[model samples]
Target: MADTEKTAIAAHLYVALRRVANRVIDIEWMAQNEEYARAIIKFAVEQGNEELARQALRYQALLDGEPAPREASARAEATPPSADTVKKRYIGTLR
Candidate 1:
């Protein structure tokens, strides 16, 4: 593809990503219209906009009351209580 065409497509993805991020595009549509959402996300991935695609998925997961996989994994890595702390807190219950 020509440089201009690539730039234009990138700009389009940027706008779409921003619209969803800013809530201007009603991300709830992602949940209600799965095909449309998948098309947007697929285009983003094809164009190498993985982060934008991920953001779109995150929006959908948020609408569904769940964390996106990356977000969940990141949370799991964030702050696990130490084994000692858990043991101390649950000592009586464990016994």
Candidate 2:
């Protein structure tokens, strides 16, 4: 990649990392920006974060109007929800 492109990707990766720290994943960004999604997947792999990589792949598939792979979908289904998601799901009921 050109230096400018690399810089842009780096900047976007930082934003993506920040979102991850905030427990937020912008699937919309991943779906719309192929380079950003690739960057996230590459970063996740380099960092040995399989879950994040899988999520990026899934988001890419969804945004590209393709069904996720059956095995990946099954594994994703088996994965437990994040604590934040659980809280959000039950918060209204607790009111």
Candidate 3:
């Protein structure tokens, strides 16, 4: 295959993988399996691929009733906070 064709094929595969990951996470959530849900997100994040991570995040948001994964208060608390997050919390407390 040509370089362009190969790139396109890879892009398509990434999208398909993201869709599958999202579905799996959703099913785990509906089953009330928080551990499995976290596992899915961890897998996606560890894959270091944007699409997979985004899909995992989307599923997390859906499970948490948030607009986005970053807005998931429970998930956010479990994960380590970033520098900016710490700053935000400190700033909020000062108000």
Candidate 4:
């Protein structure tokens, strides 16, 4: 989509985001309307808006009454050791 369209879409998401934050709109309702919530998250990701996407996901988790996801360090701790963990094959895979 054109830049103008993306901006407009982002603007709308901002309004929706505010509505969620201010509790003018029920979060449970938004959570039930999964597509709408996902739209904001997807847009943020597509636009390279990492902060926005992270916040949106956190809010969505709250709305859904789900536990927030673990932080990166915690995730690392939870991860099972891979074969050849010492070498860490993925470190070279990106090259």
Candidate 5:
């Protein structure tokens, strides 16, 4: 990858990892869409974006109760509020 593209990917992953670590920027969003993050990480890694992959790894470290670089700090309610907790349920008609 070119330097410019790598830089862009690095910055994007940095902010993403920072937000994931903080857990206050977008809790529901992240919790709901880790697939997107994983996809980006995979692409970045495939493209030889070490910095980007490092950023991705930092989030895993944070989840593992290990120290991770910080930037800011998901800093939600609704029974099964977010889709993440959604489960199949029967629906009843109301008058």
Candidate 6:
């Protein structure tokens, strides 16, 4: 990736991580309320912050005394759809 793209990605990753960490701390401070935890995860996923979603999942695992889910590697391996795919889907919807 170009330096600019790399920087943008890094910034986004940091923000997502921060949000996840904050949510986790909030849950802990709230006495491990399941409702609060679920709300955080749902909001993260709904906002298309996959990193945050994964972090929330890991938090839940740890809360249950299980191993946290594998990190960075799993996300890095998944390919997002290309512009061509999006264009095709958009055109199809016009039919």
TM-score top scorer: 6
Each candidate's number of clashing pairs is 0, 0, 0, 0, 4, 0
| lDDT (Cα) of model 6 | 0.51
Better of 3 and 6 by lDDT: 3
RMSD of candidates 1 onward, in order = 14.1, 10.6, 15.7, 15.1, 13.7, 14.4
- Lowest lDDT sum, 10 consecutive residues, model 2, at 1-10
Ranking by lDDT: 3, 2, 6, 1, 4, 5
Model 6, span 1-95: residue lDDT tens: 12323233334434675665543234333233656555655566665666766655665564466665555565545755643465578764865
**lDDT (CA) for every model shown?**
0.51, 0.52, 0.52, 0.50, 0.46, 0.51
- Please give the lDDT score for candidate 1: 0.51
Clashing pairs in 6: none
Model 4 deviation from native, Cα RMSD in Å: 15.1
| Deviation from native of the Cα of residue 88 in model 4, angstroms | 48
User: What TM-score against the true fold does each predicted structure earn?
Assistant: 0.36, 0.36, 0.38, 0.33, 0.33, 0.40
Per-residue C-alpha lDDT of model 3 across residues 1-95, encoded as one tens digit per residue:
12323233234334645575543324423235657656656676677676666656665665465554343357657778754566678764875
After superposition, the stretches of candidate 6 with alpha carbons farther than 4 Å from their true spots are 1-27, 63-65, 73-95
lDDT tens readout by residue for model 5, 6-30: 3433456656545544322333343
Clashing pairs in 3: none
Q: Tens-digit lDDT track for model 4 on 1-95? A: 22323333345446655654432333343444657656656554455455556556655554456654433466667677733374465775844
Model 1 Cα shift for residue 49 (angstroms): 2.8
Best by lDDT: 3
Model 2 segments beyond 4 Å from truth?
1-27, 60-66, 70-95
> By the TM-score metric, which is better: model 5 or model 6?
6
